[model samples]
Target: MIVADGIIELDNKNKAQGSGTAGSVLVLLSTYDSRVNDNNAIHLKNDGNSGVIYAGNGKIEVGNGNQIKEATGWKIKLKENTTVTYGQGMAGLFFTGPGGSYSLVKGTYQAK
Candidate 1:
């Protein structure tokens, strides 16, 4: 769900498993119209790698030692060895937004 100028509240957490697992949450907030806040967010998939980043032009603020992790989306199966994915992939999470904004990107990206 995409939201603007709204608040997000999550009290508990559940183990996620599926595509687009590792990702992030973008917080676009600007203060005094001078301090612009533009952060790309993306959720990692179950089979995706770590330290992936997207492209966006804006200021991104994050807490100390806070990083994005792989969080997939799946359904509960009653049968044995059953697979049910919500058909969500990296494009669903780290999709190309206004500027290719995404999450699940590693903090310390190596010089490349």
Candidate 2:
């Protein structure tokens, strides 16, 4: 869980697998405010075989050149403006709940 304001970047040229209910490689459980164009990028990638990444939880406000690359099946509950770019043959899934507001910039958005 990310509980601070920072950047998360993941560029993989290999295979990485994650198993579980969420299959999440990164989970944001707090606020990642980049409203002022801090250039903070949240890049989560799993380009390898069976490499699935997920973005779960929190209020992630990524703007001002902040980029995000999320691959695999996820259960996301975003509370801010964010962009998620996924790999080929993969999609981004957003979970619905109370206080869950996700404004996706791009990617395959699946409702779960």
Candidate 3:
């Protein structure tokens, strides 16, 4: 997991790569903007699955030719030709704050 208070910039020169076994999730959480501006700049993979990127209070800009699993932010901008594959296994994954617990909502349980 990567938590940044400010901007998180990723380019060809500075990339974010992930490699590990299954269920090894990578989380990039940024309070500010997160920019990925290059081909193959960020390759986040866990076995055959991908990772997550979240910008809590800012925007997320993804350039072309990069592979990302899922991304969420206040605003998201994707340049032409970016690849995003959603992992079904991630649907059961949830993040919680300190001392938080899981709760049932609409017949489904999730972290709160």
Of the candidates shown, which would achieve the greatest TM-score relative to the real structure? Answer: 3
* lDDT of every predicted structure (CA atoms): 0.28, 0.37, 0.59
* Per-prediction TM-score: 0.22, 0.30, 0.62
Tally clashes: model 3. Answer: 0
TM-score-sorted candidate list, best first: 3, 2, 1
Residues 52-91, model 1: lDDT tens digits: 2222322222222223322221211122222322223434
lDDT tens digits, residue span 1-112, model 3: 7777766656543445455675566777776533443222222322222357777556777766666777877667776666788765655545434554566677665334
Question: On a 0 to 1 TM-score scale, where does candidate 2 land against the true structure?
Answer: 0.30
User: What is candidate 1's TM-score against the reference?
Assistant: 0.22
lDDT of 2 by residue, 1-112 (tens): 4434455554543333344345344343323444445443344343432332332332222332223454322223222333455543233333334555556456665332
Query: Which scores better on lDDT, 2 or 3?
Result: 3
Residue 27 lDDT in model 3?
72
Top-down lDDT ranking? 3, 2, 1
